[model samples]
Target: MAAVRVEVSVLPDSVLLQILALLPPWDRLRAAGVCRRWRRLALDRAVWKHVDLSQRRLSSGSLWQLLRRVLPAGLSTLRARGCLLSASRQRLLSPALLSALGKRCPQLRCLALSETDLRRIPYASVPASLTALELRRCELPISWFHPMAPSGTLRRLLLHHVPAFADWHLMAASCQHPLRVLSLRGTHRVTEAGLLQAAPQLKGLRHLELWGCGAGDATMGAIGSHMKQLRVLEVVDCPVSSAGLGPLKSLQGLERLCLELGEKVAPKAVIALAQALPRLRELQIVGACSGMDEIRLSLSHCSCSHSPQAPD
Candidate 1:
């Protein structure tokens, strides 16, 4: 049989870019090195709109190269989890590098960093245009939330497993930023009093999640009283019971409610909550008492998920 040849270069740029987009970030970088034309197509703003470096051990030099050469200003979302931002005394994400990133990627909105040590990085160094910021297991400085610029665009903030996150940090963040959605998980230092104090400041919040916190019924009451605009509420392993959950009925706009309660929570309270929140489209109750069966039976018509284990 005669040898056949397929010229991939003949493919349309749009098609080629789509193919490149399907490749992993590292693979895409390698493909870009194939030829100048491939590199050009690979660097398309559309292809790099959302870059996920969660699996890569990105160093400072590589990060600088990415900002200066690879990433376009049109980049919107960047997820760099467990990135080695420093080695020895040198920091990977230096102030100058972060400044360069802000100047280079003006449109960047969502920045997610997990398990990355950001103790040295100031909050002011973050891109001012960002709308969403997520940090998990990051060693943040004591004054991380302090001296932050008044950001009208920054809305969603998620912090998980940040042991250093205290009541003062919450108070500072709520007072400074006009957050629409806030999620705090494994921040044990945040007490019920702190939440109550911060609740009034977060009146504009639409989505709120509290997990592994010291939130009690009082905190829930404060949220119900102040954050009437809330649409989604997730309380997992908090010290809240049915009494605290009672005030949640005031949230007429609530569409989704997730409760991963401890053994202390009653099943009847869950039922009462389901009944009160008629607007609730999705209700998930985990670790509720034996009454969960009865609650489920009562609210059979409603869309809900009742399980002993909470979904990860």
Candidate 2:
């Protein structure tokens, strides 16, 4: 038999770090358990920066062990986005992993833990350097946002499907930082007055999403007045009328706009929307808004092909 020779290029530490950083959470963890050279390469500070512990797959003990090995005290950033938990296994995170994460990944930025049980997942005194936080699904206790400590550098923030803020005043008051991107999706409890009061303070805010938000036109108007530099705005399932977005014409940076016009919006209303936000690069409309004949027909056929409504 001929000698079966395989030639492979050995990647340097820098290249290896880039490769490891791109791998999924579990794969990275496994790679860290390889030989000493690979282990050292895997444990680099940059390797575990964007940790995705979503789906709550790894046991608390295993997570702790992995963190101890790969994520040293020197780690600066940790992004655990899309973290999930079944109804039966809500409070599954152990204290050790939480402690290590809070202490080690102090400069944590872009933390996206959507649809996870965060009630018992010890909320660390968030580091000042932390910028973006997407708490999309976790219905944390009111105490979570009670700390009034201002994070001057914090930028993007997204809150979706969380419990109503019992003390909305305190919650809004606590957000002294200037935000760039903000999303308040499915926050039924947040009244228009509360949001209007807080919107102006976030002077740097450019992108805003109020999906299923119960705020009225007055609040929407208030937001528009304050957010002069606003770019992209999504008012999904909200009742903001043509008048609400009328002021958006002044927004020179406006790019994308999404609105659910509901069952009875006339044809003229839809045309008005396109005219109002003329610079819109992308527009998504749901329900019975008229004047979008081509869009409606296309959507109707698309919806019928699958399950009618867009798949979850």
Point out where model 2 deviates above 4 Å.
1-14, 58-63, 72-77, 81-102, 115-124, 166-174, 276-278, 294-312
- Evaluated with TM-score, which candidate comes out highest? 1
Worst 10 residues of 2 by lDDT: 301-310
Estimate the TM-score of every prediction: 0.91, 0.76
RMSD of each: 3.1, 5.5
Write the residue-wise lDDT of candidate 2 on 116-148 in tens digits: 566554344445556777776665655555446
Stretches of candidate 1 above 4 Å error?
A: 1-11, 83-86, 262-265
Please provide, for model 1 over 180-224, each residue's C-alpha lDDT reduced to its tens digit, 9 standing for 90 to 100: 999999998999888988888999999999988888888888988
Go through the candidates in order and give each one's C-alpha lDDT. 0.82, 0.61
User: What's the lDDT for residue 178 in model 2?
Assistant: 65
Worst 10 residues of 1 by lDDT: 83-92
